[model samples]
Target: MEKLTAIIPVFNEQDTIERAIVSVLFADEILIVDSFSTDLTLSIAEKYDVKIIQRDYEYSASQKNWAIPQASNNWILILDADEVIGSSLREEIQSILNKKSTKTGYWIYRNNHFMNQAIKYSGWQNDKVVRLFQRDLCRYEDKRVHAEIITSGDLGFLNSKIDHFTYKSLRQYVEKLNRYAALQAIDYDKITDKITAYHLLLKPLWRFLKHFIIQKGYKDGVAGTVICFLQAYAVVMRYANLYLLRKKN
Candidate 1:
């Protein structure tokens, strides 16, 4: 059989590390790249029989790029610590590897849950990401926030969904917004001229409107509302932080 390896990047994810690692045991090798987590994340991962690679914290793209070459197998399945693979998804992945995959990488539709609610209207539908790929054909860009895998060949989507327990509570959502905003600010700082008032204000409102109305956040009720609001707030913070960075420079 052609070798398939699962690669996961983690940071202080003690709550979900074990499940994440177990989900990929079907692979020839399971490799986890750690960012010096100050929790039981390392210990939990160790119990799962995965090869652990330690490195300092960095952006998502950088971390994933660093992990790709470390994989022992030619094919790699990249998964985040918070994501879980259902049996259907696992079987789908195996099927793809068994034959010639249509594309250099496979994009999986992600299903994210917020506060125990499956938020349908929060603009997260058919959230496709190219995580499973031939190790030599793909790498992620260096964007600090909203990083995505870069692939040269055609893209194909997996029918099964990768479950993402993205937010356990409103607080977690807020914290992520703040963290991502800071990263985006730093990421955009290099472009100095990109910071503008519209991004700081109008764009955020528009984002909220897009999510709450265009994307139909109303169906998810409170969780959808919160998700849209947090997205808008993240937009505001990104520009605000960028503006400050520009002022300092």
Candidate 2:
């Protein structure tokens, strides 16, 4: 059996840190990379026999990349503070480790919950991420948001899914969106020549259409509709911030 290390990066996630840590207790070791959270997140994490390391967060990819090499095992399971591994998924992971697999990485699907409701659509229907990988064979791209893993070997999929408690409330969703938009704007500003109508208007509309219509967001009901709309709004804010940065320069 391959030794597994669960790496979780967190910042002020006191409310869900314990739950996240408990879900991954099956791993041989649990490593928490914290970003100097000004809350009880660290305290809660300390309750468990997990290794905790604090670093100033620059971006998600950078944080995880730095922590991956410090893991005690070759197999690394990257999990977020708001995510929980289900019993079936845990059993499946154990089964995989028991077998002689050649794959270097595995993609896990997520069942995301928004406002305490399971969102089956809103472009999040097919939310699959490469969370399990061999530490020496994989690295994350240096992106501020939505960074993907770069793997050296072939990837496989897991049948079990992780339960992601995405956003507890609308307020939390908006707050997170604002933070992500700021990071996105910084990234866009470097490559964007100038803010055009496409950035502010057409792009947002297209996003809404893609999620709500093309992605069948309506099937999830009001929660899905709101999420799709807010996602589009986040896009508008990203460009708006970029435009402001251009004006200041």
TM-scores, one per candidate = 0.95, 0.96
Pick by TM-score: which candidate is best? 2
Shift in Å, residue 44, candidate 1: 1.1
Query: What tens digits encode model 1's per-residue C-alpha lDDT throughout 130-161?
Result: 88888888888889887877878777888999
Candidate 1 local distance difference test against the native: 0.85
Instruction: Please provide, for model 2 over 1-249, each residue's C-alpha lDDT reduced to its tens digit, 9 standing for 90 to 100.
Output: 999999999999999999999999999999999999999999999999999998999989999999999999999999999999999999999988888789999999999999779998899989999999899999998789999899778999999999999886788889989888988888887788777898889999999999999999999898999999998999999998787777888
Task: Provide the clashing-pair count of each candidate structure.
Answer: 0, 0
lDDT value, residue 86 of candidate 2: 93
Each model's lDDT: 0.85, 0.93
Q: What stretches of model 1 exceed 4 Å from their correct place?
A: 190-196
RMSD of each: 1.5, 1.2
Lowest summed-lDDT stretch of 10 residues in model 1? Answer: 188-197
Residue pairs with backbone overlap in model 2: none
